[model samples]
Target chain A: MQHRLCFAPLNGLILLVSACVLALPMPASAQDKVLRWHDNLDRAAQASRESGKPLFVVFRCVR
Target chain B: MNGVDLARFEFDYDTTWQAFFLDANLNVYSRYGGRDEKSADGRHSVASLQHTMNEVLVAHERRRRPESRSDADLQPAPRSKTTPEDIPLLKAGHQGCVHCHQIAEYRALQSFHDGKFSRDSIFGFPLPDNVGINFDLAHGHRVDAVVPESPAAKGGLAPGDVVTRVDDVPVRSEQDFRWALHRVVEKRSVVVTALRAAGSKPSQPVSIKLDFHADWRKTDLGWRKSLRSVPLPLGFLGYALGREERRTAKLPDGRLAIKVVSLRGGGLAGNLGLEKGDLIVSLAGRSDERTLDDFKSDLLRRYAPGDKVRLTVLRDGKSLELTGPFPPWDTTDTSVP
Candidate 1:
């Protein structure tokens, strides 16, 4: 069964402020296995230039 | 410590996750993320992400033809002020990759300081539920659920209803819903047309009358992503105390309180004499009886930068009130914390 996350009660201010201290930006490759991801945007841009494939960028927090 | 990609694609910053599909030329084909305060993954699904990827590939293929590119497609995105390296704390000693929250705060603070923080910049991407409709993106952006007693439900929306249009725009993806919701600000009504399917029967046409309160757009402006060119609000950092903690503090029931947890050095709050460990009970005459979320929305949506705001705080078991000049939202001021 897929567990759907509920965000109804969380405060945006709390979440954003908390991320500064509680969360760190980590490479998606370290956690997600579905797609081989790029941690750096410039590197991804460079790779896109070479392969002509579109950039699948996920700007996220690893909290 | 360096600022990178802060001005890249337009993103919904309040959302915990934002996925974008773009070409090598920086052309944004589409986006695949939507979030509200309730769920970190609001409206986001693996199926939708994969669907967007496929659409992006097709858009790329079409762009190969010279005629496919239009003036709208060629426009360059605006740039943001002050990169990560320019931030004093990061430049001083803060190591590791810069977090999104840090970037969000810094950017908003810069915009706030620059005096450009406005309704649109502060409250950019509103959630779908602001109108009481949740989209099931996996099933062609169908109406997954409607909040009971919400504008959607009041207008006659039910589960399994497929949203076909919001206002006059066609709704094919979550982004389309965002585009529709974007035009609704303050107090305004929007026409939503959907297809309702009852059991195994053929779907019937349904129209939902959706209107939002003046503060609806204000719902979570603090989390909305600021565009590269837009300004921001006050740069102080604080968190709402949990219910249990509020009870432990010996406060009256149902009073909304925010505890000052951290402050950026030279941040507006610190500069204005607000300190860490201070318990904020009220701002601009609003007290703890209101939810922190509502209080924040009221402050941001109603007040402008430079507006003098009276603050009430609880410190060392003493109740105190203080009034000060709000920070100047000057984005060009690089001296910000």
Candidate 2:
């Protein structure tokens, strides 16, 4: 009975640690740092106008 | 790409990736990406991109200044918006999404059929390395090395000098420099303005005149996706024989020796009875040392559609001659996919 009692608290502590770890936010990856790319050139241009920032338009042919 | 203004978004259509740094009013500040025959992204790097972005930001900030407001180039010029749908050839046949390469291909085809195609148009966006100036990958505009006895060296472009402008075009990046080179129509000499930085003093702009050779714009076209639209088809896939293979075939050193691997159906070679495994020893009696791509380019340069072509082949140690008219530049297929 004493041995069971001793192991029960240890198991609970392990579960608590795992839960804490899971609750922690994920670190941002290198890809996450990339600026949001807009497919619509007009919309992007509009954003550029509103923000007074220069537009960086990229054309990439996937095939 | 359908409704986008192609005139404002002009770039090398042969490239898979290209970028333009412009303002909201569509005043282009610079460009970022370019490629050679080596590879698509070989000339680009993250550092170079970062450098271009920083330079664009600086230029944007300068334009925003009160004194710079009067700069004519900073003002957006009025242009009639032309889209991919505006192109008659594309409008007639293509539907749905239109690729960048298709734009180049259809336009070139239109030019070809209209009897206005220039051979120089095939070699678009020639690299600065062609002029003997190798830009530092990280700095984009700074010359890292100059080829010995190249035009850049002859023109007094030294390493560490930052290119400011090419002719009248303000060069802010390597792609910008290439754009300047691409715009050279008949001028054999180009004036390159660069800023030479000396120790603890302001940079001074130095002008260098680059005298180009007749073939300065020529580059390897094998890597281009738009090369297919040129209408010159070899009708057979050839593999260049290695040094040992050439020796085994009893071919002379430093000469053309390619093994025909496969023949295209209804192709000129197939029509002329060119079989697989036939070793091509010479083309038009010219046994020059040339790669398969080089040989293809040679054909494009020397012959047009329906031109006569002659090839000498070896089969089982027996020499055979094949001659036929080159295939007509077909316009039936306009789709890039």
Candidate 3:
């Protein structure tokens, strides 16, 4: 019983890892490539809120 | 505890009186064990209904009443056919299949430009691809928007071109026209005839071919459930934006300037500051010269949202830089229509 209980969690962990491994390869969506402006999310958050527009886009130059 | 119970619980693990005791226990275990467990009263109701149906069926069967079984036809049907006449068909037919099957709406409105947009590929605004139909209902008699730059576009089929014939077939009704389309060879360019006018006597014929790869929005005759949201071709992306042309503007030198009249969605307007009757001239910094294709790639594939955009606005004749984030594609407004 003890071994069975322990194995269930281990099996779950393996299943989760497997699922992520399967989903890792697709290309990013139009909304997925958000550029990070500042180290903290504050600047991005303020821009999004103040933009008054429902959809706010942030592009960063990563030279 | 027994083999039978295990099997029974495995299948009926979620419902029924037999599983009722296990439900509370499972809830307790989940809450304590840090596992998520949930239930729906709908299932219980459905299971009870199923039990009642089964009992009725069995009772009727065991009674050996053949006549009564025949009488079952008089009983009300368990399910009603969903034939809602109020619902207009989204597609050419009364079928609503494409709208239901295609869930990717609120979807991508992209243009068929060279390379997909990346950060370095910010072409100012996203370029838009034209609809596959001619929106004019008048020309709708022949063909809708011949998809932008598609084989139909390249083949010479314009928006108002009334499709009168396909090779030799006469397209009287939508069905007749569709049948002719079915007969055409995929990717083989063929001549098509259209009346060109609602009351025009002689029909003008033009040739167009299908490309090897078909646009996803093409309404191929298919089976569909009738109950679905109305389908709008081009996914609601209308042809060329900036229709409100000939408006006023203020130049940076306190003078008047040219306002960008109209713009298509997934186009450069979604990125630039030159709104209706504003002013224009000078893009990016220092009046960078850019091509239409170059400006479109950025919005579609490259940037997400909240990116800094610097545009040189020639408002009032003073070259001042207008700074703002690119407007997220907001086509929600019906005002444009």
Candidate 4:
């Protein structure tokens, strides 16, 4: 019964940790799969060629 | 953007943000961003961007279709690639990074030095409102509203019509329409084609001729960063007086009351002996209700290089006159910043 009691807390702790990890925000690299971005034009052009998708080039003057 | 193809990717240099929709071969499908003096983000919307993306996708698919091989629209134009490094003036001016506004500035300065500069060059990428057509924010090329008695209205443009082309240039977005309008070098009538849908019938193409008058390309130049490069130099930065300040100066409402706060050294105002705290009451002997921008636009429109200007200033408790001739427009030396 004492061993069962100790194992029950360990199971509960594992469940709580799993939930926390699942709830965490996705990493940028993973999210990039949905909306890929490339700072370099050559890489973006290559991706566009391979995927047969159009390129959306944005020229932003931050200043 | 150092190696960016200037010949293929031309846009409004003054805009802080711009987007180009292109294909894998670097063939431009359409442009997606433009702005007016109203606000930077006023003409842009997420909905409009989505609409443009969908349209571009359709166009891309159509181009890929085997049967569409004969389509001229799918063919890329022959253009000689020119980058910022190709421009000698720009290369000579800056060492590291070259800005978009600097591209326009150096080009204008070079044109001025080459004696090919026109005053109209100062105005670039005019808004469609100049033609009296207000585009829908959600659908960039769709007419949301047409000003009554405007050129668009008189030419049979109505709200809800989808603009297809301007002067035979296919307009896929509002920026494309502006690009077509910007190419209009002379004040003349240009054809605008649109598609109108009635009830359940197929959309029918409609053509309208819009007559443009002189000064139709002019817009609020105050927000344009490239305007600083224009040879028409306003040597002093003037702040418009508020109602309280105007009343304190005994200036009536709806009258010009600009307070000169600072002067550029060796500028026209400094050369005219315009003081730092001088309250300018009138310009060219007229006092009207105008903001600082309106005043600047008027100054640019009314006077040319080498033209004489008279300013009525209120110094201390007395009024004084400051008159001087503008420096020659082409007097800018090789050391242009």
Candidate 5:
């Protein structure tokens, strides 16, 4: 009976840790394609020039 | 690894996020994104973004045809007051992780150093809601809400109507709407083209003539970067209660109950015996629709600097009436305890 009581608390702690791991947020790249964006402005411009497409530029801060 | 030339394009410095739609040659076709003081992403919408992208594509095609191109085929961006390299903070070798707020703050500091600080410097660009059109960005610049009896509603703008164009500029996003509105300096009627039931049943075009009243420029200020020396907009030099705050104070609804939390610059409010915890019930002999936001907007939009305004407040559970002239935005001559 004493060993079973000790193991019960251990099982509860493991369950709690597993729940927390599951609840962790996914990285930006895993969630949205927009978040996983390219940062090479020069490449974007070059592509625009070659393909005759307008270069869409965005200026912002992650913080 | 190149940087966007900041001097060529004009953007709302107060906004946290801004985007530019340009031709391959760097000629700007239009802009997107805008925010009001209440929310950081107030007027942004995905549909508006899609619309702006479509317009830019069309403008791109027009640029190729020499005969179809006119002097205004693709307009050059307006020159800004300062460039990114001109800002001291940006020039300090920390421009890699540049934030939008820092750009505005540094620009204002440079403006003050150059002796060009004005009301427009701190106020920046006014939100489109000032004209009473709450654009739904997700629905492609559709009307989300219209202020009752406002110029938008009276001009025939209804909810769910898609704004296709403002004046001669193609309306795609909130930024385009603001850009068009910003160009209108005079108090003239603005033409708006909206389509009802867009992409659904038979759609019809609606023309709206939005007329502005005198003193419309005094509407509301957006969040802007300013130096500590720059006093708050409209010279109040104090803070007012928000809606949630009123409920916490047990103040009744449908009446203005602004709790004066602090007074600064020894301005008129502090000089006239107004202190912290004073609840303002009425101003200018008007007590109807008394909310702090509404009152502040009305006070600033209706009165100018040096104009005296009457106020009634409840301090220490006692009623008091105070009147004083509006103070300048940079008054440091007076001090308060």
Candidate 6:
């Protein structure tokens, strides 16, 4: 069973902080895949030109 | 937003993107550790790393999963975290707000509650006059209403309970709650002293630490996305700490400015009738105030259920008096991207 989890907006800050205290931390094994910020193009921009919205990049955890 | 959809939408082929991300992360994570007190402070640093990756993956999947759902528009995607990193590209990829954090951003957010990014902007939000919390109940959640799903829920708190104190401070009023919050300035998770009200008498207190959302909404501000579809330099745009009820400031004219972030939410920001853009040059006839210290004071760390306080603010260049309650919370973590 894949137990899903959610964290703060900080790429690593939230998880880093949570790791210190969450009772049963969200284990790496819970999901096999992860979000690697190697340039999703949209993630690099400051604001959007088309939608006039900033990009919300989400990486998935593959279990 | 899910992997399936992300991959499906791709009309071209490029395996290079995946390879670079994995390799880059290996470097960043390698340099970082889970338990470095000097850095991460002993606690569960490694656990935090794990959670960070965990949330990333979950967010990616959440965004992508819905595209595959039978009904596309009918079934909305799940909410994502609203932190800075999630804002896609609010800032051009050039700016990294490593130093200018929650505290630094407070200045830019002066017109936040009113939705005015600038004093010259024609649009803004309808902010309440005061923001306050009300946590007048037993701890351990004997009452469903008392349990704030955000912190209390994470702290393993359910409704129908009793909270004697946070960090050993007897919670008698809302001000006390604000003080409690201020006390835990840097504590990731604090020692929550609680008693279950389920029994004839109070149950033994239980202490637990939880990872909660930033609780920015409590600050009495609107976290607005871009008015247009264009990407902003940052995502999740809003006040960092939200707004305090009343804050005294010295205008260039040497007049005491009283600005109230909000009193409707709760806390000193509210108890004192603090309003948006109001300034306070003094409190109780004393102009004693510390800018940075107040942002990171232990006294502010104790905000929890059933806390009360008193505060004063300057509104329209006039001093205003106010008092109110600050209770625990349950919130719309919709911003959790």
Clash counts for the predictions, in order: 20, 0, 35, 0, 2, 133
Task: Give per-model CA RMSD.
Answer: 9.3, 12.0, 26.0, 11.1, 11.7, 18.6
- Where does candidate 2 stray beyond 4 Å? A1-34, B70-80, B233-278, B282-294, B301-312, B319-337
Off by over 4 Å in 5: A1-27, A31-43, B1-4, B65-76, B79-81, B84-98, B102-124, B127-129, B132-138, B142-168, B186-210, B222-230, B233-250, B253-265, B285-299, B331-337
- Models 1 onward score TM values of 0.55, 0.77, 0.21, 0.79, 0.67, 0.23
Candidate 2 lDDT, tens digit per residue, B43-146?
A: 87776766766667777878888887544333233277788887677888887677777788887777766767767888878889889999998788899999
Model 5 Cα displacement at B144 (Å)?
7.5
Model 4 regions more than 4 Å off: A1-33, B70-78, B235-256, B261-277, B282-294, B302-337
**Candidate 4's DockQ:** 0.24
Write one digit per residue (lDDT tens) for candidate 5, span A12-48. Answer: 1111000101123433443233222334555655656
For B1-337, candidate 5 gives per-residue lDDT tens digits of 0133556556765565566666555666767666765677656655456656666677677777887775354544565544566665356544353444555655555555555655444444556677788876675477899988888978989998888778777666777777777777654778998888867668798889999755444545423333233442432434455668768766666676666766654565754567777888888877754445456556655555577878898877788999877665443312111
Clashing pairs in 4: none
lDDT of 1: 0.59
Candidate 3 stretches with Cα past 4 Å from truth are A1-63, B1-131, B138-140, B184-188, B196-204, B210-337
Better of 2 and 6 by DockQ: 2
* Of 4 and 6, the candidate ranking higher by DockQ: 4
lDDT of 6 at B42: 30
Worst 10 residues of 6 chain B by lDDT: B11-20
Residue lDDT tens for model 4, B1-337:
5767777778887777777777777777777678887787788876676677677677777888898743444324436988877767777776666677777877777777777877778778878898899999988999999998878988999999999878756777899889888777875778988999887999899999999767777777777666666766667787899999988889899888889898876566855788889988889988987777767767776666677888898999799998888655643544245
Best by DockQ: 1
Q: What is the interface RMSD of each candidate, in Å?
A: 9.1, 20.1, 25.3, 18.5, 19.3, 16.0
Of candidate 5 chain B, the 10-residue stretch with the lowest lDDT total is: B328-337
Encode model 3's per-residue lDDT on A7-63: one tens digit a residue. Answer: 212211111000111223434344223322222223433443453211111111111
| Poorest lDDT segment (10 consecutive residues) of candidate 3 chain B | B27-36
Per-residue lDDT of candidate 6, residues A1-63 (tens digit): 123223333343212111111234354443324532222433333222332222222222121
Chain B vs. true chain B: TM-score per candidate = 0.56, 0.80, 0.24, 0.84, 0.68, 0.25
> RMSD in angstroms, candidate 2?
12.0
Better of 2 and 6 by lDDT: 2
TM-score of chain A of 1: 0.45
Fnat for each model: 0.62, 0.62, 0.00, 0.64, 0.52, 0.00
